[model samples]
Target: MNQIRPLIPLLVTAGILIGGNGLQGTFISLRALQEGFSPSVIGLVGTGYNLGFAIGCVYITRVIRSIGHIRAFSALAAIASAASISMVLLIDPFFWFLMRLIQGICFAGLFATVESWLNARVTNATRARTLSVYRFVDLGSVTLAQYLIPTVGIDGFQLFAIISMALTLSLVPISFADRSSPEPPDAVRFNVKTLWQISPLATVGCIVVGLTNSVFRSLGPVYAQGIGMSIAAIATFMSVGIFAGVVLQYPLGHYSDKLDRRKIILVATLGSLAAGVFIAFVAGDSTLLNYAGIFFFGAFAMPLYSLCSAHANDHAKEGQHALVSAGTLFFWSIGAVIGPLFASFMLDIFGPHALFIYMAAVLALFLAYTVQRMTVREGVPAEKRTMSFRNLLRTSTFFNKLATPPSEDKPENK
Candidate 1:
């Protein structure tokens, strides 16, 4: 606790920032639906946000370098706050899409700034514990934010106001902190050939996870409403899934570390398939069953990215960790951009249950691919795998630098 005391302010800021952004996604989806936007249009709003996020990942480092972390963070947070409010005033699908894009870009910068700031404050000795705390705060705050949705009421301007207020509040803590800014992060790099050589299963796993997860995150509220769930129920449904992921990630990841990760991936996919079946076919009119199904679905699905990342790092030669991480993120973002748009089209034609059908089909395809890959290549011997499963959780673009080899930690590399 004492070791983390100095970092409390930054962590608080992170919770507030992420909570606001998390609420914004679900709120926008519900509000857009209320305003008579088609699922396809709403899906494009999601796609636009992800597209901006992907582009921001490539360029945000330079912005931080030029302006310094505090300024960059403050600027981005201000823009995000304004963007949240703008959605209420504009009320048009195109305008909302643009605002979502701006929100995405700002969030990418905000995440990069906060993570880089936190990275600078800890020594190698404290890095692991500090990051564990960081991850906990991140997941917990997001879950709490989902529950906050019902409190704000999805049908009015008050929710947008609340979102903007949270974003604004996030800027306050870091503004008063006494620490200096960290050096700018290294530029992101992606080479598909290198990633594929490292682990083909990991590469495909990332893309598939991106597809299914983005669809749920962006469109789940819409599905819930379409199927006659109350706003409060929608909140519970979303929060429960996220909370399940937090609870399940470490256990699933631990098992993957002990066994062939490809096998674990297959098991997780089967779990997802079962959850989809329950949600789509068996859980009719029982909210408890629906929540249980979604919870299990999130448990099995959310950890695949970390599992895939760890598997890839298992085969990564020295100094290739960061590159592999970036490449995985690149593929995931590509999938994110495409996932919502396609899922929205399905929803438009086939109704709410079509969302799960799409998810199940994807999981089946991933399951088959993993089985085939198991036959083609051998798992990394336990003794040969160097990266820790816990550390693999930090491979998201926000913490990409931490995944890099120690030799590359020099300032000159940045």
Candidate 2:
């Protein structure tokens, strides 16, 4: 039963993550369309979500650490459910922005609880498989969102509301069913600054991942619209990229596990660099080429965060995994907040190609930073190597969790 108990919570959490947050990326666009927001303003709204998400990650961990996983998990779910409804009821951009911030915080808290729960349950033997299962749920849920949006119509916030509610409700059973785990420690105390000092490449890698990911999510549609692609073309562009990333995770991860993990970074970064060039040179001219380009981009680009996390984990203290995970999330959210606003401005100034250009530039810097790490290149200890998990889980679900900050009522490290 203990073996299966882990499976239950894991599956339930996966369902909640996919059903809830996965729908949101497309849903925001649909809602923005209905609300008539300008591209720049739409980007700002996304920025607000990132700002809120960062706060949630830092604070929400503390909440779970202090309150016990069960209670904190329930509170987060309820908050998210209510926040989703509130955003629908209060449809004005200003009000929705406010609600999105609230939702960001709540969603972050819930995500932290679930991530912590997964870590708490599994021993070393199961960590890889657990991560794989989690990834599958993550991707499966989000991919479902692309299809769901057209079915419901972009203007139908109510259906999105139903989807959000269903996701939140899924958590209730998992929250109650799992025997209460011990609270997260008070100080999984590797200083963020210290961690950055140890692995500047990894630190900057998190930022890059955040920058490219949010930029794509917030502005991908804008590019499709500007290029005069059909709606199906737009969806295909986004979906195929996501699928390519999903398929690439295991092969890449296995390779990373077997070799110098940093080499994998170099390889992925270079591949992303090539994909960016493909985007810059050809995507604007042919929709099929654009689709193929973004697909390659996803294959190389999307896994950066997981790779960053794994790299950091390679150097982490035993109890520090959650802290490091959340920290990477914090940095990622920081990037996320800035990503869209910059991309939107560039889009307005230069047109759709700026989106690809923005992505290309970010990858260039990531490659440069990784190359700059001579010490890492020369003598990274074999035992300390960080092997990133297979991209099997859509771990982006955890990004929402990062939005929560340290809750005032709880300990700091949580």
Candidate 3:
């Protein structure tokens, strides 16, 4: 506790920032539905945000490099606060889409700034513990934000006002902190060929997880409303899944370290496939069953990104962890941008259940791919695996470059 005392202010800043961001995301989904936007349009709004996030990953490094972390973080937070309020003023679907895009960019920058700042403070001995605290704060705050939805009521302007307030409040701690800002991080590089040489299964797994997770994050509220859930129930539904992910991540990661990570991936994917089927076909009308299914689904699906990343790093040379991490994030972002649009289209044509159908199909395909890859390549020998876990919780390009050491040797395509 004493070791972490110095970092408390930054952690509080993260909590505030994430809480506001979480509320804004869920609020947008519900509010857009109330405004009579079609499912397809809501999906496009999600796609727009992810597209902007991807762009931010590519470019926010320059912004930080030019202005430095403290300035860049403040600027992005202001933009995010304004973007939250703008949604209320501009009620048009197209206008909201634009706002979401800007919000995504701001969020991408905010995450980069905060995470890079945190990474800078910790030494190698404290890296794991500090990252654990950071992850707990992030997931805990997001879950808490969901419960706030019922208090704010989705239809009122008050929620937007609250979101803006949170964003504004987040800046206070950082502004007053005594620590100096970290040097700007290098830009993330995406090298597909090198990643493939390291681990093909990990590459594909990142993309597949991105597709399934983004669909749920962006459109789950719409599905909940379609199934006649109340606002409070929607909050519970979303929060439960996220909470499940947080609770399960450590256990699953520990077990994966002991076995072939691909085996872990296959089992998790299979569980995800089953959960998707249950949600789509067997959980009708019983909200408890629906919630239970989502909880289990989150358990199995949410950690796959970290699993894939860990597996890739198992094969990576000592200095190449950062490159492998960056490549995986690049693929995940690509999938995130595409998933919501596809899921939304399915929702439009076949109703809410189609969301699960799309997810189940993706998981099934990934399952098959994982099985095939298992036959092709053996897992990294236990003696050869890296034991320390690195946090890849946020989709910040800067974090990837910072986590990875500079590498002179690049793997040729297999």
Which candidate number maximizes lDDT? Answer: 3
TM-score of each: 0.94, 0.84, 0.94
Candidate 3 C-alpha lDDT tens digits along 192-221: 789988898989998998899988899999
Q: What is candidate 3's CA lDDT for residue 313? A: 85
| TM-score comparison, 1 vs 2, better candidate | 1
lDDT of 1 by residue, 1-414 (tens): 877777888889988987787788888898899899999999999998888787777778789889998999889989989998988887898888888888888888888788778766766666767777777887888888887777767777898999999999988888766566777766666688899888888898889987998899899998889889999999889888777776677787888888887777888899988998889888876788989999999888888788888888888887777777778887788888899999999999999989999999999998998899888888887776777564343223657554434444343243
Q: For residues 256-330, could you state the per-residue lDDT of candidate 2 as single tens digits?
A: 666666778888888887888888777666898888888888888877776776676566554455566556766
Superior candidate under lDDT, 2 versus 3? 3
Order of models, best lDDT first:
3, 1, 2
For candidate 3, the lDDT comes to: 0.83
* TM-score of model 3 (CA atoms): 0.94
Question: In model 2, how many backbone clashes occur?
Answer: 26
After superposition, which runs of candidate 1 have C-alpha atoms over 4 Å from their true positions? 391-396, 400-414
Each prediction's whole-model lDDT (CA): 0.82, 0.68, 0.83
